[model samples]
Structure formats: structure tokens, C-alpha cells
Target chain A: MDTLLSGQLLFAALVSGSLYALIALGLNLVYGTLRLLNIAHGDLVMIGAYTAFWLFTLLSIPPVVSFFVAAALCALLGWAVYEGMFRRLLANPGLAKRVEANSLILFYGISVILQNLTALAFTSSSRGYQYLDTVITWQGVSMTGNRLLSLGVAGGICIAALLFLRFHLFGWELRAVIQRREAAQIVGVNLNRVQPIIICAGFAIAGIAGVLVSMTEQITPFMGFPFTIIAFVVIIIGGLGNIGAGVLAGLSLGLIETYGVALTSPGYRSILIYGLFVAVLLIRPEGIFTKAVRS
Target chain B: MKALDIIFGLALAIGGLLVPLSGDAYLMGLVFQLAMWIALAQSWSMLSSTTGYLSLGHAVFYGIGAYVCVLLTGVVPFGVALAAGAAASAVFAGLIGLPVLRVQGPYFVILTYGLAELVRNVVMRIESALGSFGRMIFMVPSFEVLVWCMVALGILATLGAAAVRHSALGAGLAAIRENEVAAETVGVPVARLKLLAFVASATIPGAVGGLALLRTGYFEPAQAFDPVISFTIVTMALVGGTETVRGPVLGALGFTLLSEALWSSLPQLYMIVLGLTLIAFILFVPRGLSGLADRALGRG
Candidate 1:
């Protein structure tokens, strides 16, 4: 109980919360605008981590600078994916009802391809690199500088994303698409252009988050699916299609996880998280933050 | 065309049944996998394809059955353990069906996936707490016996899927799939039928899982509840053609053969090829291999 209230746990919760929000925002953005459930979202993150890892390992580029490169790569990949695969599916009005399921299956395939390809390339071993690992102590709390940096970067990106959605013209167009696809088209929001942008932005955000993850944790080809699941839980908690609430919900889930794990052993962590997800789903299918965006 | 399909399906089943007689270990093993996947995919198709709910959590039922059957094998007759596994899964389906089936679309899909992962973690924790890394089943049935059991299950599951697809329940399920609200408005017992299908579709996988554990002579929670099993089931159902019972059989046959061909030489490459093939199937051959067969034979 004492440990639960300690400043260290609080700091840890904040950092983890920021990470969750970072991962979930990208997934929510893609799903909100395009209705594309990119189960491969996590694999995108994995790619970003690997990108940073290789850049630092081979070329000695710091993750701070390499993340942008990785994010750009991801954005390009997203554009190609949209053009090559999802565009045809989305263009078919006859498939409107089954689009979600179809996209889910398509992305599941994409995930398999990405994971196995990464495994083939990287040999399925875990990889990590040290950067800014010096411990810092302040106000009765201490953490590695890398973790502190990750927290700041993740939090900053999440805020920038929310602000972009709230104030930017393209952000408004993206929201228009999310709220009502047909209505957005009627209002002259060019879906073909807006959709690719949303997908790219979504991938870039996940890429950035992946870079932060690599800073603080070990990564492997298979690390992405759990993050995908985490993103789903976060978006569900925050209310689907609501970006602002997604951040808040991500933070809340982080606290829940931190405190829940503190109360029990580490092994019970997944059970607790998934239990919360199932409970929220059964009790409030729309979301805990349903009124945030809908009303 | 329908009669031709039936004959073709019967021939394949008879051919599968004869695999054990050859006494070749490799052939029996491959046939067992074919039968196992056929049963799993066919059972999955019964609920997901007909109803369009698209469950990705079928692995939970399979895992639970394997766990229970493995635990009870020493305590009870093997047949009883298998039945107990099936019954346990049916009960689990019935219990979760009410709240689970309430949601629709992507919610239903993710919820099911999350629940399966949840069960997996729970089982993992239990195993660790019990200090059992993974259980090794002793006095397991012979390879031929296990393959025969799996083949029997495959036939039963295929028959059950066909029976469901043609029955009043199947019609009601199709209506629900077309539109749940309208189906409910028209006096269909939507909830009851959905639950029945969910439970029915769940039973065979349980028994099939038990047979799988026996065949392997081991039980590990991670392997038993792997989400890849769920993904493969969905892929096979979609690839085979979900509209008819014959789709799953063909899909299982095709997928198993493909995997066998590629797995030994290059496993990772096989997965990549599978992923690409699945993508191609979705984009171009949405109706699946069975649908292509239907068209080639002049009718669907």
C-alpha cells in the first residue's frame, strides 16, 4: 500500500501511461477515419524499433534523430499499402458492410507477413540498445534518463496529435471522415486524399512510439502484437473514434496496470488488463468515455 | 454440381480414412493434421460463417478441452475424458455466449480475441503456480488410434456443419447475419439461435483438441492456446469458401498440403507465402477455392 502511493510508482505510471497513449492514438486515428483495423499496427512499431536499433548499431545514429527517419519510412509504407491493398477494398460500395471484417482479415495477413519477414531478417532474437541510461533523482523519485526522455517525447506527441485534431484544417477533415464517411464526402472532404494521409499519419505516430519503446525495453519481431492488443484496449476504454479520450484512457489504464501489478505479482498483469478489457466491453460496449465524442 | 461436390468430398474422406492402414508414420501424421484442421475449420464455419459474427477466439475452447482432457486422462477413461472436454467447452460457450454475442462487428471480433488471450494468460498463471512447466501425457493412444479419432471428428464436424447450414436454425442464422435487427423484428429467436450455434460450433474443437494433445503426447498452455490457431481457422474458413460446408474441407486440404510442401525447406518463407496467398485470396478470390470450384462446375 505504501509502495502504491510512492512517488516512484506515480512516475512510473505516468511514463507507462504516456507510452500507451502514444501507441493507442495512432491505431485510433487509423480506425476512426478509414475504419481499417490494422492488426499490423504493432508490427509497424516493431519495424520502427528495429530501424532505430539498426541505425544506432550500424551507423551510430541516436534514436532521438533516427525516429523521424523510421516514422517517414513507415508513412511511405502506409501509402503503398493503401494504394496496393486497402484502396480496392474501400472503393467497393458493394462490400461496405463486410469491409471491417475483410480489412481485419487482410491486416491479419499483413501482420503474419511482417512478423515472419522480420523474424527471417532478424533471426527472432531480442535486441536492445543503451541510450541516455543515466539515472536521475529529483523530488524523492529516480528514473533512467532514457525513460524520462521517452515519457516527455510520448506525452508531447500525444498532445500534438490532440491539438492537431482540434485545430488543424486537415485534422478537421480527418474528423469529418471519422464522424461520418458519407457526410464528409458530401461536404467536399476528398476521401481518397484524406484517407491516405490519415493512414500515413497513423503509421508515423506508431513508429514514433516504437522508437520510444526501444529506448526503454527489449524488442523482438513478435513484440508488436501485444502492443496492438494494448492499443485496442486503450481505444476501447477511451471510446472508439475519440482521440482526446483515448489519451486519457491510456493513462488511466497505465495506472490501473501499475497499481494492479503492484498489488499482485507480475504474472497476473495480463489477466488483470484483459479482465478489465472484457469487463468494460461487457458493461459498456460503446466505451467508458462514450459521451466524450458522441454527445 | 452439388452431387459432384458431395462425391468428391466423400472420396477425400475415404482416402483420409485409409491413411492409417499404410503404417507410414509421416503419412499418418500429415493425415492427422489434415483431419484436425478440417474439423476445426468446419466447426468454426458453423457459427462464424453462417452467422457472420467472425469469432477469433475458437482457440479458447480448444485449449480448455486440451487442458481438461489432459488433466482427466489419468483419472478417468480416455473416452470419458474426451467427452468431458467437449462438455466443458459447450458449457463455456453457453456461459459466455450471452454477453459476448451481444456485441457485433469489430467489437465482437476483438472481444473474442481478448477473451481468448485472457484465458491463455490465466492458464499460464495456473500452470506456473502449480509448478508444472508443461504436462506430459503418459500411456497415450497409439498414432493410428489418434489419427482415426481425429478423422472421425472431422467427419462428424463436417456433417454437423452441413446439418446446421440446411436446418431452420441455419436459415435463422443466415437471416441474422444479413441483418440482426430485421431478423429480430421478424420473430426469429436471435439470441437463442446464436447461443445454440456458438455452443454447437464449440463442441467438436474441444474433442479435436483432446485428440491433438494425445497425438503430441504433451500439453503446453502457450502452444495449446496460440492465437495463430485462431487466425489459421479464420483463414482456412475464408479461403475455402464460407458459404458451404465443403469449403473448409478443401481449405484444410489445400492449406495442409501447402504447409507440408514448404515447412521443411523454409518455414519463415512458408508463412510469408501463406500471408501473401491469403491476401491474394481476399482481394481476388473473395468467394474462396470452393467458390471457384463451384463456378468451374457451372453452378454455386
Candidate 2:
């Protein structure tokens, strides 16, 4: 039990939780605005991680610069996915359910495509970044420079996003669109312009998460599945339409999962997270935090 | 028309039996695998299409049945073990369905997937207790008997789908799929219908998986609980048109053959191909191959 409070374990859990929160924020953003469950959210993370990896390894770019580039690329991809696929599907509400189903198939296909392409291009060897002297310890509480930096960055990004939503012209318009698409259109919100930006912003956030995760762990083609499921659990646990709930759920899950692994085995950690999700769904079908209807 | 349908079913059964006699082991193996997949796909369709509960954990039921069959092989005759396996799977489905079916839509899908992962992890942890992972084996039945059993089960499952699709219970399920609140208001027992669909769907996969283990004489947790199995079976059901009887069968056969051919050659792009196939079908041919057939026959 004393091992539970070990600085290493606590630090690791915090780091993991921070990363989870980052990923969940992206999922929450997309679901919040679109009311679409994107199973491919994890794959987007994977794409971001791969993008960072390539930029760092091949182009000899620094990790920090690569992260932003990867994020920007993912934002573009997200916008393209919406413009190409989701737009057509949204026109017919009856076909919406089938389109969602098709998205899973398509994204899963994209995952396979990315994984295989990566495997073909750069053989299936596990790759990790060269860690510099980046460890920081204070009074026996140790944390990695990369992790702490990422946490700070995630915090800054989330805060900025909140402010943007509350104050920016497009952000308010986007919120209006989310609240009532028909009403927003009637009230002169240009949905055609707003939807693309929201999706791109969401993907950019997901890409940032991907880059952060890659820094802590090695990148693999199939790493998307576990992360994807984790993000899903987080968004589901946090209300679907609430960003704060997503952050809260993600951090809580990360802490629980980390402690679960510390107490039992890492193998049982995912089971516990899943069990928690099932329990949450059974107890509160609408999620933990309900979004207030905004005027 | 009903007589013609019955005759077509009988002719297919006779054709299945005659295949093994031709001494083509490769073809026999393919046919056997196809039959098993058809059973699985049909059962999965029963739960997902009929009840509108997209379960990503049907493989969990299949794995349970396989594991039970493996465990009971030492205590009972192989046939008895298979029965026990199927029963265990059905019972397990009923138990899991009680809590899980309360949720709807994506929640249900995610929960079922989690359930499958939970089962897999549990199996992995207890591997030493059960015997080492992939180390345990069950004795196989005679090839002739195995073939006949599989064919019988396949035919029964097909008929079961047809029956369920046309029954009063089927109408209730359809209503639930179309609109849950309305169905509940209209006196349809939503939870009970879902449970029944889940249990019934579970039975075929359980039996099929048990029989597959019997035929293969081996069991592995990862192999038994593979997401690929879940995805493939679901894809077949959806591709064939979810709510139809003939859809899953045709979907399973075509998907299996397509996968066997493509995966063997382009293992890398196979999943991508499958994903593209699913996306294309959903977008353009949302009704699936069965829907296509219905249109060709001017029944749509």
C-alpha cells in the first residue's frame, strides 16, 4: 500500500492522466459540436504521432516543432474528412445513422492504411525518441521535462480554447450552430464556414494529444486502438457535449488506470477502466455532467 | 414460394454433404469454415439488426463457448461438451445482456467491446490456471460427423433467422429498431425482446465456436477473442443487410472468400480493403447485397 504513494507512481499517474485528458478534450470537442461519435479519433492521434515521428526522424526537426506541424496536418485532414464525407451524410437525417456506421468502417480502414503504409515505408520496428537530460525531480517528486511541458501546453491550449469559445465571433457562431443548427442558420450563422473550422480545431487538439503521447511512449502503428477506446470511455463518462466533463473524465480515468496498474497489473488496468465505464453508463446514462442550455 | 424456399434450403444442405465425399480436403475445409462464419454472422445479425443493439462482443460469447468446450472435453463426450459450451455461452449472454442492454446506440457498442476486452484479459490472466495460453487442446470428433453437425446447425440458424424475422416477436424487435419509445408505449417489452435476441443470437455463435474448437482441437484466448472475428462477422451481417435472413449467409460466404483471397496476397492492405468495402457498401449500396438482390427481383 505504501507503494501507492511512491513518487514515481504518483508522477507516472499524473503524467498518464494529463495525456488522457488531452486526448479526451479532442473527442469531447467533436462530439460536443457535431453530435457524431468519431471512433477514428484515436487514429487521428496515431496520425499525429506518426507525423511527428517522421518530421523528427527524417527531417531532423526538433520534437517541439514537429508537434505543431503534425497538429496542423491533422487539422487539415479533419477538415477534409468533414468536407468530403460528413457533409454529404448530414444532408439526409435518415441516412445519418448509416453514415456514422460507415465512418467507423472508413476510419478503421484509414487506420489500417496508415499502419500498413508506415510498416511498408519504415519497417515494423518499435521506435522511440532519444531522450535528452529532461528529468526533473523536486523533493523526491520526479517528473519528466517532456511530460511537464506537455501538461502546461495542454492546460494553456484548453484555457485558450475556452476563452475562444466564450469570446471569439466564430466561436460564438459555432456554439450557436451546436445549440440549434436550424435556428443558427435562420439567425444568419454561416454554418458552411463555421463547421469546417470547428472540425479542424478539434483535430488539431487531438493531434496535439498524439504528439504528447508519443513523447512519453514509443509509437506503433496499432497504438490507436487502446487510446481510441480510452478516449471513448472518457467522452462517454464526461457528458458528450461538455468539454470540462471530458477533461475531468480523462484525468480521472488516467489516475484510476494508473493506480489500477500500480495496485494490480497493467493487464488489469484496461479492464478496470472498462468496468468503470460500464458502471457509469448503468448509473448515469446521460454522463456525469449535463450541459446547460445556452441562450 | 415458401416450398421453393424450403427446397432451396434442402438442396443447399444436400450440396454441403456431398462436398466432403468428393475427397477435396481444401474445399471441405473452406466450406466448413464458411458454414461456421455464416452461423456466427447470422447470430450476430439477430442481435444487432433485429434488436438494434450493436454488440462488439459477440466474440466473447463465441470464446466462452469454445473455452467451455475445451474445459469439458475431459469430463464428457465431445458432443456433450459442445452442448455445454453453447449453453454456457447462452447463459453468459443472458447475464451480460441484463445490465448492458439497458444502454442504447453507441453506448451499447462500446460497452460490448469493453466486455470482450474484459473477457480476453481475464482469460489471459487465468491462462496458467486453465493451462498455458494456446497450450490446451480438445479432442476432435470424426470429420464426417463434424461436417454433418455444422451443416445441420447452419441450416437451423438460417431457418431460425427466417422464423424470427416473421414472428410477432420479430415485429416487436423491428418496432424497437425503428423507434424504441414508441415500441415501449405500444406494449412491446423492449428489455425482454433484446434479452431474447441476445440469448438466441449467442447460441449459434457459441455452438459454432465450440464446434470450431472441436474441429481444430485447439483454443487460444487471443484467437478466440479476436476483434477481427467481431469486425468480420459484423461486417458480413451489415453487408448482407442486417435484418434479412439470406443477407448474413451470403455476406459471410462472400466476405470470407474475399478475405481469404485478399488477405493471403495483400495482408497489409486487407483491413484497408475491408474498410473501403464497408464504406462503399454503406454509401452507395446501403441495403447490401441482399438489397441488391431484392431490387433485381423487383421485390423492393
Candidate 3:
């Protein structure tokens, strides 16, 4: 038990929590604003990771630069998805709800397409990068500099996101649309313009998170499944559509999972996470926080 | 009309029986597997379509039945094990459905999907439960016996769907599907009806899963609890037509044959094909094959 309280484990859990928070935040943003459960969100994360991997491996780009490039590419992809798929669905009055279900199938198909494409291009082997060589060791505890850097970056992103939503005009319009789509439309708020931006921003966040996660973990085409599941659980726990709650839930999950792994086998950690989800769902289906989004 | 329907049904049944006897072993196996899939699709439709609760985790029940049957056969005869597996799956369905069924729409779908993953992870981690090897298969029976078992299951599944579609419980389920609060206010026991549908839905899949496990003489966690199976079953139900007695069976037959053909020709692109097909069905034929048939036949 003493070994569990070591600074290394604590730092590791915090770092993992930061990354999980990033993933959860991406999911919450889309779910909150769009009311669309994008099952392809995880695939976006995978795409981001793959993009970064290719930039670093093929183009000889630095990790940090690759991360931004990956995020930008994902944002573009998100825009295309909205313009091509979701926009058409939203245009139809009767097909709105059906669109959500249909999108699951569509996105899942896209996911398969992307995964197979990656497999065809790169083969089904794991990949990694070793750009950051800094390591900090103190009092018999060691931690990687890259992890600390990712955590700091994630924190910065979260703060920036919150501020953007709080102060920016476009963010305000986005919120307005989410809160009352018809009212926003009545006010001449161009939903057609705003929705694509929101979707792009959401995908960008997920892509960045993907890049960050890949730094700490191995990159594989199938890595999105666990991320998707974890993010979904986090969003559900934090109260769907609430960004702050997602962060809290993600952090809590990270800590819980870290300690859970330390105490039990890694296999049992998932069960515990799911048990927490079921427990929360049974007790408070609305999640730990139910504050309405400012939108 | 009733006489014609009966005659057609008998002819179809006889055709299915003759396939195994006259067809090659591989072809017969494929036909049998198709029948099993049809049974699974029908069971899924009974719950998802009629109840409007799209469960993305139904493989949990199927896997449970398969695992239970495999385990129980050591202590009991094959027939008893099969029944036990079905009963056990029903019990599991009823239990899991309790908390989940409370949620509406997408929440229910997500929760069910998560629950299925949880079950899969639990099974994977608990080596003792599924054995260290992850799956265990029982000894296979003779081809004739296996054929009879599958035929009996197909008939039972069809009858079950027909019964559910016409029963008082079916009416209540339909009401709940239409509007839960309204159904509740109108004296329909919403929870009870859902639980009944869920449990009843489990019976055919459980039995068929057990039979499938016996037929293949092997089982694996990945094979038994694949999300693809759930997707395939739901797709068949939706593509064939949901909330109709014959829709799922028709869906199963069509989907399985399509899948086999695709797999044989373009194995790598089979899933992609399925995905595109699903997308087309969702976009163009939301009501599935039955709707298409109705349109083509000039029937309202």
C-alpha cells in the first residue's frame, strides 16, 4: 500500500487524468452543443494520432509541430463530415432523430474504412515516437518530461477553451444555438456557419488529445476503442454536455483506474470503472453535475 | 389466403429441411448457420423493434447462453443444457433490463452497449469463468441431429414472433414503444411489459447460441460476443423490416446470404460492404425490406 502512494504513481495518475480530461472534454463539447452522439469521435482521435505519427515518421517533423498539424487536419475532417453528412441530415425535418442513428452506422463504416486504410498503408503494427528525452527524477521517483508537458498543455487547452466559450462572440453564438436553435435562427444567427465551426473545434480538441495520448502510449489503429469507451464513461459521469463535470469525471476515472490497477489486475480496472458508471447511472442518471450549459 | 400462407410456410420449411440432405456439407453448414442467424435477428427484432429500445449489446445474452450451455453439458445432457442456457439468458436479460430500461432513447442504447463491453471485459479478465483459453466448445452431435435442432429452433422462433405479435402483451409492448408515459397512464405496466419482452427475446437467441456452439464444436469470446454480430442482427431486422412477425426472418435470410457471397468474393471488403449497405438502408429504406416490398407490390 505504501508503494501505491509513491510520487511516481501519483504523477502518473495525474498525467493520465489530464489526457482523459482532454478526451472527455472533446466528447462533451460535441454532445453538449450538437446533441449528436458522434460514435466516430474516437476515430477522430485515431486519425489525429495517425496524422501525428506520419508527420513525425515520414516528414521528419518535430512532435510538437506534428501535434498541431494533426489537430488542424482533424478540424478540416470534422468540417467535411458536417458539410457532407450531418448538414444534409439536419436539413430534413423528419429525419433528425433518424439521422443520429444513421450517423452511428455511417461513422462506424467510416471508422472501418479508416482503420482498413491505415492497415493497408502501414500494416497492423504498433508505432511510437521518441522526441522528448527529458526525464525528471527526485526522491527515488522518476517521471517523463513529455508526460508533464502534455499535462501542462492539456490544462492550458482547457483554460483556453473555457475562456473562449465564456468571452468569444462565436462561442456565445454557438451557445445560443445549442440553447435554442430556433431562437438563434430567428435572430439571424447563421446556423449553417456556426455548426461547422463547432464541429471542427470539437474534432480539433479530440485530435489534440489523441496526439497527447499517443505520446504516452503506443499508437495503433485500434487504439480508439478504449479511448471512446473511457470518454463516453467520463461524459456520462460528469453529466452529459457539461465540460467542467467531464474534467472532474475524467480525473476521477484516471485516479480510480491507476489505483485500481495498483490494487488489482489491469483487467479488473475496467470492471471497476464500469461499476462506477453503473453506480452513478443508478443513483444519478443526470451525472454528478447537472448545471445547464451556459448555452 | 390463410391456406395459401400455410402452404407457402410448409413449402419453405420443407425446402430448408431438404438443403442439408441434398446439399454439400459446406453449403449445408452455411444454410444452417443462416437459419441460426435468422433466428437471432428475429429475437433481436422482437425486443428492439417492437419495444423501440435499440440494444447494441444483445450478444451478451447470446454469449451467456453459449457459455452456460457449454458449461452445463458436463453436468447434464445436451438437451437439458440447451434449455438451461435459454432459461439462464432470460434471467440475465430480465436482471440487466431493469435499470437500463428506465432510461429512454439514446441513453438506453449507450448503456446497453457499455454493459455488453463490461460483460466482455469481465469474461476476458476472469480466466476461471471462461477457462484460461477464453472459450470452450462441447463435442459435436451428428449432422442429422444438428439439422433437426436447427429446424426446431427456426420453427420455434417463427412461432414465438407470431405469438408475440398477436398477444395482449404485444399490444402493451406496442403501446410502450409508441409512448411510455402515455402507456403508463393508460394502465399498461411499462416496466413489466419491457421486462417480459426482454426475457422473451432472450429465449430464442439463447437456444440458438447453444445450438450454434454445439454445431461449431468451438467458441471464443471474440466470436461469441462480437459487436459485429449485434450489428448484423439489428441490421437484418431493420433492413428486413422491424416490428413485423416475418420481417426479421426475411432479414436474416437475405443478410446471411449476402454476407456469405460477399465474404467469398471480397472478404476484405465484407464489413465495408455491410456498412455501406446499412447506410443505404438507413437513408433510403428506413422501414426496411417490408416497406420496399409494399411499395414494389403496390400495397399501401
Candidate 4:
């Protein structure tokens, strides 16, 4: 009945969907390459938000620029984590075969560590910044400037990532490593050399996703787990290791979540997200993009 | 050597039960938590380590037991309520496990977690059963009664774990863990056995969680269904050792004492310490304390 309301919801969904897609993409990358779930992806995102928050509040840097700053920081931190934690775990003959289960537990510990440290450094209180908080309205459609900016950054990054994966030489290696580990190895794709870089990039992307969300949202120490859950839902829906489906599913889920909340109370939103997630998981663990999903 | 191991394990277990006789509520409470945690970790170990499927959302059954008994206590005899609650949890797990267990590894993990969160959210909406920060009081028989119940539950948990570890059913679980397809090819009833294990695993945690609620005399969805509880149970089991009853028992008790120390001194830092400990355990001591004990005994 209300076109304006529907339009507003649609826009909001696109923004959220794009953000979720970025997160799913990042998680998918790690899962795809290493055959490990980085449950710490959410914590990395939280840290990115903190990085952006501190950059703006402490040093008076513009929030937009802090996007790259946060990304770079996470990449560095991710590489260190990869070297320190994952490399050792992957090296173990017992754990390497059970990487999926082992990595999940390993990252859970890392998640706990990061969440507690964030609480210690920032305290548990939620923090927000005045970064593009201004609202813009046009012909009955309205959103905060920060929301729009985050959407733009998210879209830009997703597209750039796609293009990079399409054109870059590393893309071929990434695809091979993720899709054809054995063949890739025979073809001289050095998993030892390539995986750490991929993990590092994945961490950076997750940080970028975190910073993007923090722009229009409040930051909290405990926000990591929820975001991690969302990432799980998105990637699962899109099919793990399938970037295209993740993007589409991410956008769709974001829309559904935004519009569902708009239609019902906010409390029921989680129920909707979780219900859909379970349904998809039980029905099709391979994901909606069943055709060549792993590829 | 085997005889010595059994005697050592029994001594430690019996020693643990004797602690509550001291009549210190502080120490008793810690013991109670340790018992509940042991049961939970063992339940998790049953489905996870033996079956090789990491269940990320075990709190669903645990919370079900909490809610079901709380709701049924007055309508039925307290004993009946507790038993019914656990049975209901098993039935529920069996039902969900049918479809969800089809997905393995990360998918299974995510689905289980989602199921728990979903159930908790729905449970919170029941205004009659729980208010915001829901509080309820059922007459706890006695501190000793509570302790004895935990002891009994611990005994039951150990027996169940031992059965799974040593029985032919346990071999099926190991087969599934090694390779489900191969196990199925070898005529292991993968689905049926998994469901059976999933159902059996759900029962004890339900009982443990329900008992914990009755003892607390207060309940809230947030606290009762806390994801952290599942995480804590899993960590305790992992540190003690996975797939063995004694492993979770020792790990749960050891971590409980360690937490009591850390929580009193620095509540904020304790989680970080636990987290770091988990990482360290995964990196250097994957078999946990029980594994270390086994190695020492083997050397000796």
C-alpha cells in the first residue's frame, strides 16, 4: 500500500545485503582455500570497527579513509595469525586432515580472545561516531549519508574484488586451489605460498566489511559473534565456496531482513533470519546455487 | 597397567564427590557447576568426538531440559517432570537430527547453532514462563541433595560415555567418524546410529540443565540458553580430552577451579585467559589433560 515505505526498505536491504555479501565473500574465501572456517572473521570485523572508531576519535582522521586503514591493519594482523596459528595447525598431519573441525575450534578460541581484548580495551559499552550521520531525502526515499556511503564502499569493493578475481593471475590459482586442490598441487600451485596470502586478503576483506557496517551502526564488543552468524547464514545459503551465490543470497537475505523488520517488530527479525537459515541448511547443505557451487 | 588406570580414575572421581561434604556453599556451588559441566561436555563429546561432527549449538537440548522441567514441575511429580523433560529433549533432538545431520562439518555446526538461537528466541517470547530476566523458584531438596543428584548424574554420564567408548555402537560411531561413506558401504547404519547417538547424547545434558535450573531457583532465557554455556562446555571437554568420559570430567573440574580463581581476581581477563588456554591446548596439547595422563602412564 505504501510505495514510499517499500522503496525505503528496498534501499536499506541493498545496503545491508551488500555488506553481508562482502562478509560472506571473505568467509567463503578462507573456507574455499584452506578448507577451514575462520570463526574469528567476525572478531576481525569488530576489531576493524574499533580501528575505524579510534582513528576518527583519537587521531581525527576522516572515517572514509579509515576504511582502507582498517583493511590494511587486518591484513597485517591476519597474516600474523595465519603464520602463528593456522600454519602450525595445518602442518600437523592429524589436524590437517581434520582441518574443517579443527580450524572451527581454533578460530573459536581466537574469537574469544579478540572479543575479550576488545572489551578490555574499549570496555563493553557500545560506541558510535558522527561519520556521515546526516540523512538525505529525495522524492520520498531517505537514508543516512553514512548508510549510503557504506553501501557505496561495499558495492565498490565487491565489484573490485570480482574484477580482481577475474583478471588477476592470482585468481586462477585461487580457483584451482579451492576447487582442485590435488590438480592445483600437481600443476605447481604452491598452497604453502598461496594460502597465507589468501587468508590475509580474506581477513582484510572481513575488516572492510566491519568498518562498513560500523559506519551506520553502533559498535560493540559482542557484535562479532552475531556478524559471524550472519556470514555463516549467507555463505550457507549461497553455498560455501560459491561467490556468486553468496552475493545474490547476501543481497536477498539483507532485503528480507530489512523488509521483514520493517513489516514486523525488530525482535522477530532474528527469528526470521535463523529460521530461513535452518531451513536452507536442512534442505540443501550444498546451497541454492547447486550447479557448480563448489567451483 | 589397565588395572592401575581404572583405580586412579575411580579415586579421582570419588574424591571429587567427597568435596561437598565440607558444607561450604562456595565450594559446593563450584562442585555443582563442575558436575553439570562434566555432564554437558561428555554429552558433547559423545556426539562430537566419537561421531566426528562438531555440534556448535548443543545448548538447544540443554535449554529445552531447563524450560521443560521448569514448566512441568508443578503439574507432575518433580521426578516425573525431570524425566519427561529429558525424554522430550531426546525426542526433539532425534527429530531435528534426522534432517540436519545430513549436513556435515561446518554446515552441521551452523545449523545446530541456529537451531539453539532460534529456540531460545522463541522461548523468550513466552511471557508467562519467563519475564525479562525470568526468575522462578522450585524448592531445591537440599545442598546435599543437589550435590548427590549431580553425583548421580555424573555417574550416569560416565557410564553412558563408557558404553559409547567401549560398545559395538561405539565402533559404529568411530566408523562414521573415519569416513561416513565407507562406513555406510561397510553396512554401518550411519543415519540410524547417528540419530541414536544424537538422541542419547541429548538426554543427559537435558537432565543436567534441568537440575541446574531447579537448583538456581531463578531462570532467564539469556542465562539459561546462553551460547557461552555451550562454548564453555565444549572447551572443558576439549581440554580434558575429547571422546572419553573421564577426559571431560577432569577437564570440567580443573577448568571450573581455574575459573573460580580467575573470576574472583579479574572477571574481565578470565575469558581472555580461557580463550588463550584453548588456543594453547589446540596447538600444543590437543589430547588435553587426560591424554597427558595417558602418555605419562604409558611411559611409567
Task: Give the number of the best model, judged by lDDT.
Answer: 1
Residue lDDT tens for model 1, B50-74: 9999999999999999999999998
Docking class of 1: high
Give per-residue CA lDDT, model 1, range A1-295, as digits (tens): 7888899999999999999999999999998998888899999999999999999999999999988998999999899999999899988775556888889889999999999999998899999999999989998899999989889999999998889889999889988888888889999999889889889999998898889899889999999998998898999998888889899999998899998899898999999989988988888877898774453
lDDT of 4 by residue, A84-190 (tens): 98899888998788788788888888898889888888789999888877779976788888888888888887888777777898888888887788899999899
TM-score-based ranking: 1, 4, 2, 3
Candidate no. 1 TM-score: 0.98
Give per-residue CA lDDT, model 4, range B1-300, as digits (tens): 557757866775686688778888887787788778877888888888799887888898888888888878767877777797789889899888888789887678777888999988888876433445576766656777777677778777877888888999899999999899999999999999999889988998888878888898777877778888888888888888884566887788788888888888777688888888888998899888888878887842
i-RMSD of model 1 (Å, 1 decimal): 0.9
Q: Model 3 residue A31 lDDT?
A: 73
TM-score for each candidate, following the candidate numbering: 0.98, 0.93, 0.93, 0.96
After superposition, the stretches of candidate 3 with alpha carbons farther than 4 Å from their true spots are A98-102, A138-140, A180-188, A291-295, B1-11, B128-131, B264-266
For model 2, fnat equals 0.47
lDDT of 1: 0.91
Share of native C-alpha contacts between chains A and B (below 8 angstroms) recovered by candidate 3? 0.33
Assess the local accuracy of residue B294 in candidate 1 as a C-alpha lDDT between 0 and 100. Answer: 82
Largest TM-score belongs to which candidate?
Answer: 1
TM-score of chain A of 1: 0.97
lDDT string, candidate 2, A1-295, tens digits: 8779787777777677777877887877776666657777887887788877777778878668877887899899888888877787666666676544555555655566666766666666777775443778887877778888777777677667778878998778877776677898999988777767777888888888888777778888777878888887887788666777777787788788888888887667756877777777777767876654444
Tens-place lDDT digits, model 3, residues B197-266: 8888888788887888887777676677777677777777877888466677667777778778887776
Worst 10 residues of 1 chain B by lDDT: B1-10
Residue pairs with backbone overlap in model 2: none
lDDT by residue (B18-45, candidate 2, tens digit) is 8778767777777787788778887887
Residue B4 accuracy (lDDT) in model 4: 70
The regions of model 2 sitting more than 4 angstroms off are A97-102, A179-181, A291-295, B1-11, B128-131, B298-300
Write the number of the candidate with greater DockQ, choosing between 3 and 4: 4
